[model samples]
Target: MDLASEEDKEITIGAFNGWDESYAAAYNTKYALEQDGFTVAVESFDAGPAFTAVSQGDIDFIMDGWLPVTHEDYIQQFGDDMEAQGCWYIDAKNTIAVNEDSPAQSMADLADMADEYGSTIYGIEAGAGLTRMMQDNMIPTYGLEDWDFKISSTPAMLAQLASSTDAGENIVVTLWRPHWAYDAFPVRDLEDPEGAMGAGEVVYNFSYAGFTEDHPQVSQLLKNLVISDEDLASMENIMFSDDHYGGEDPDGAVAEWVEENDSFVSDWKAGALAG
Candidate 1:
């Protein structure tokens, strides 16, 4: 448990591509571990590959696994090979959102106003659980079979959102809570009367099976971690800003956040390392 120990000094964290919360969690943990004299590496991959890497012990852990819903299949497949560190954020949900001024107030309304939205519903990566839900449930449940469900990266969807909003045009996109987009864009989630998107979920950290045994102190640190929505949103607002987007200086953003919230950082570290 010695902070200066040479053993278990290095760690690797896996993240989903273009997920802002994933980056926020990974980089925040990296900074914290570094403060304890541990070296950490943050790597990005699609959800499926990221889960595979962590389960097979190719990486140490991941800080962003939405559970009991969004990633139920991944956990059912890989849970035996990994340990749930804990839930760090809660009440998370996948959503289909539109600008505040849009006339559609619910999912049911989308079908009738499909033409106004250009008959398209922008979405993130095809492999994302949100994408699966939309394809298998939301679309069919809401009678949107004839509408176009555009599949692309998260950044692409965000770009489309930005463009549409700027032009004062109605647009619909699949999104989620605890996301920076909610703050960055003038959007609101459409009410899902059918509840096809599922209920609120918890975001958890999962490490390789033997990670806790190999690094008990670090494991304890992770177990003690919890981030509030406001704090997480604030950090992400900075991390995903124009200056820090596209893998530019995210570490610096974390550093700035840490500096601004020294007491919170100190309390978290002390609670974990305390006997």
Candidate 2:
């Protein structure tokens, strides 16, 4: 029975909290692995640490790499040891959004209308890649020299959006796709013609080299899990609903999402088996 190198029956999935898309994918996949009899260990970290952990094989894999821009530097640094997998969610991206009623329709318009938005651009965590990109690229490229890019956590930023939106005030913040806020509020992304933030992002499942060869079944399932914004948002809505989590405990939201999307989950599992 011990003829070969001991195979790890347990797989650890690394993720970062506050980022809804990342959290959703990793949490849901953890449940899926459990269904396949794999003891799933979950770990949480900031984006940078998560990248390094996966690179050193300290963490098995991550399901929320926003590629082609966000996480590019991290991949360049540690990606030699990483196997970037499928683009599970293609519309993943970051943007500056204002109330749907705001007059500024694009990044170009933000500079002139900064006063209208209270001369402030509320942003997520200071360490976020999106924040870096906005600070380093978007503001300068858009001629928003007079505006303030306020650094705050995602939850805080969302709260700001809530208060601003409730009073029908014009407010802009750094937001991304695959978030529950789209359903919870009326906001739209400001068009970026200069491509300061690069093209729309695609969230990828990243594993260490030889992951497929070592764990073929689970690898295939993660690779085959292609979901749209609506599907993911629906999952977030249920899993993160106050009635579910904040009202009590986590309440097995991912499993509930899987059960609701039994057809999709079944197809992915079948593909893995066949692969």
Candidate 3:
């Protein structure tokens, strides 16, 4: 009889920065897979770098692709190279939030207050898909050609926002729903006159092409995965409930949720063994 190949098998999952909202779901999935006896590795990369790495197969998967919009090109190029696991969050929306007292109530309002607001828009890292959308579409479409946009990473941008909001100064920063900021701050989303940013999007997971074949049971669990706004909100709430609530404990919360939803978990596990 021929011996099977000696090479060991392991799954590597990729994620954006450690602070991304999807980090929790990714950890939860990792925990679930490990429970089934598979050796798994978790890797972190910048959002843009993560897409490139996954495309080149340097990473096994990224569980945080916001869909039908952001990262559209990345999905098109690398999607065929991987298997889409499942939907994570269905309505992840991006917003342009200004300080609560800012006179700019909408994109149109920004035009009138461009001078007072410094003729500049605060954005996350320039490479972020949303930042590109803001520059390539929101700016031009809204006719803010002369307006300047400052691109900084999330922590940096949020820091600027905190300073401005605390002083009740005029400020605008790219924001998103289902993010920790929504739970921690009272900023408002500016109305879109041209609708350039598009509506909320569906977030999903992706794995290497043969992941399902190599780990059918684990793939099944991923396929049955579905998270709603309430689910995400609960996680965010825990992170902000108190100074002692800790932060971003997605895996722990997921495990707790699963145990409390045994019937639902069983349904997901059902038929998975046949694969």
**Candidate 2 residue lDDT tens string, 199-223:** 7878889998888788776777787
Model 1: CA > 4 A from native: 1-7, 45-58, 69-78, 111-120, 125-129, 145-153, 241-243, 260-263, 270-275
How does candidate 1 score on lDDT? 0.86
TM-scores, each model vs. reference: 0.78, 0.78, 0.67
Clashes of each: 0, 0, 0
Residues 131-169, model 1: lDDT tens digits: 999999999999999999999988899899999998999
Q: Which scores higher on lDDT, 1 or 2?
A: 1
Cα-based lDDT for every prediction? 0.86, 0.79, 0.71
RMSD of each: 4.0, 4.8, 6.6
| Model 1 error, position 245 (Å) | 3.3
| Model 3: how far residue 267 lies from native, Å | 9.9
Between which residue pairs do clashes occur in model 2? none
Question: Taking the tens digit of each residue's C-alpha lDDT, what string does model 3 give over 1-275?
Answer: 01022123466788777545666666666766666565777788887788787767787778898888877888888778778887757768777888776778788777778777999888898788789889878888878888888888977787887778778788888987676565455577888877887888888788777876765656666777775555555555454334314454556656665665455445445533222
Q: How high is the lDDT of residue 250 in model 3?
A: 54
